[model samples]
Target: MTPQEWVTSGDDQAGDIPSPVGFRILIKPYRLPKFSAGGIALVGESKQYADIAKVAGQVLKMGSECYRGERFSAPWCKIGDYVIFPKHAGQTIEVKRNDGQDPDQYLLVNDDEIRAVVKDPSQIKAYL
Candidate 1:
């Protein structure tokens, strides 16, 4: 919910993070590789992320793409992060850290609504 919606609801504080559901997520480690800098690695096996065509864009998921329609956006999800989507109503999905054997999909990490994973403080602060 947006800030205004959250406040009008009055059920809880806006600062209290809601659950994450139906969100295209980005999975990543709380602490990323300062060494790797820019590279794609599998989810879990490494902290590296998959740098894709729209990796650094502001909008995590634009809802439509020229080639890949409704593609899952946001590759920076992590444990305890809240996610939301139309598919999942009334409940949100919280991103949890998983161990992936492959490094290539590290950038693929996971899917959620948020721009980046809650694991990345940088990404979280931006939303705040």
Candidate 2:
């Protein structure tokens, strides 16, 4: 499906939701505290990670000027790229999800706030 169709389709299968505009990019942060280095499951440590971890997120959508903007003038990342950002980098917004908890949280960050892109997000170390 086309990007426009994906955005408007209202299907919450973990891919295709909202589209960002201008210099904003939508990122879905990776789940934190799933397990510890010592092989202990951090079942309820999500809150701790959310409070004090620089997050790695998969890029969902890129704004029109993300690659060629008047502000930054060069693109360092693209859609589907994994990115690292500060713990307080972007504005957090929740979107509806298939899971019946609170809406899934997504970060809306400017192109400049993206620190680095990763080939494999799982390889990045998660802090406790």
Candidate 3:
């Protein structure tokens, strides 16, 4: 999905999301587009791996102690920023929706795990 669509379509209802603790950050990983640039439909395996190997995500929440340590003079990122992280860096969490739609996936990574912030998440090309 495009960055704008990702933000607008997010499940942000109250009491649905978990607040991060310590120096962790809550991130909602970007879902792979259903079709490639050439309009070829992606297979289920490809979509599943997108969730497993998430590289770009929007910062949803921050722990109380994030960026407060000596290592950081200031916060590297904040909520609403799109960030890049290692494919296998964080713990993956899935939240089931009450409407019985597919559960949403999120990544819980340490604040220091963020490598860079992106101006647009859709421009990121993640390889399988």
Give a tens-digit lDDT track for model 3, residues 1-128. Answer: 56878755746542388899999999988877778878988878886776556588899999999999788999999999999998888898888776677777788999999999998877776676
- Model 1 gets an lDDT of 0.28
Computed on alpha carbons, the lDDT of every model, listed in order, comes to 0.28, 0.70, 0.83
- Please give the clash total of every predicted structure, in order: 33, 0, 0
Candidates' RMSD to native: 17.3, 6.4, 2.2
Alpha-carbon TM-score of each model against the true structure: 0.16, 0.70, 0.86
The full ranking of all candidates by TM-score, starting with the best, is 3, 2, 1
Off by over 4 Å in 1: 1-31, 34-102, 106-112, 115-128
* TM-score top scorer: 3
Ranking by lDDT: 3, 2, 1
Better candidate by TM-score, 1 or 3: 3
Q: Write the per-residue lDDT of candidate 2 for residues 1-128, one digit (tens) a residue.
A: 22234233333544346788988899877654445657766654564654356477778888887767466666888887788887778799877667554566689998889889986554565465
Task: Determine which window of 10 residues in candidate 3 has minimal summed lDDT.
Answer: 6-15
Q: What is the lDDT of residue 86 in candidate 3?
A: 89
Model 2 residue 46 CA deviation (Å) reads: 6.3
